[model samples]
Target: MKDTKILLLLVIGVPILGLVYCAFMIGFLLLVPWGQNHPIITAAIFVLTPSIVSGSIWLISSARAKK
Candidate 1:
């Protein structure tokens, strides 16, 4: 039961956290002016950072599990 609960938490929590991070990144991008150089790079960074962060969090959490 405890293991199932942890699995459930990871399944639900990771994606929700990732989506929230993505939303924040999108909001920040929207607030930025379009005239800047390398807009594509900026956009990529905004999208990728949160994803990487979320993946790292998931990896770390799973690695530290007692099982």
Candidate 2:
């Protein structure tokens, strides 16, 4: 893969995938009728999941660049 391609993907893919994951997770959480209705947990889900996913994407891209 080319450097430009990798950079472009990192610019685009990280936010897109991270947001998708966050939306999906939060949407599912809200859609459910049962569960511990905790605000902190919800906040953590909003923050952590996307962050971890984005970081993972970045790490993967870094690894790929090394290869």
- Candidate 2 lDDT (Cα, 0 to 1): 0.80
lDDT of 2 by residue, 1-67 (tens): 9999999999999899878876877786778644247666767877787579879999999999999
TM-score of 2: 0.54
lDDT of 1 by residue, 1-67 (tens): 6999999988999899879977876776667666154678887887688679879989999989956
lDDT of each: 0.79, 0.80
Model 1 residue 19 CA deviation in Å: 1.3
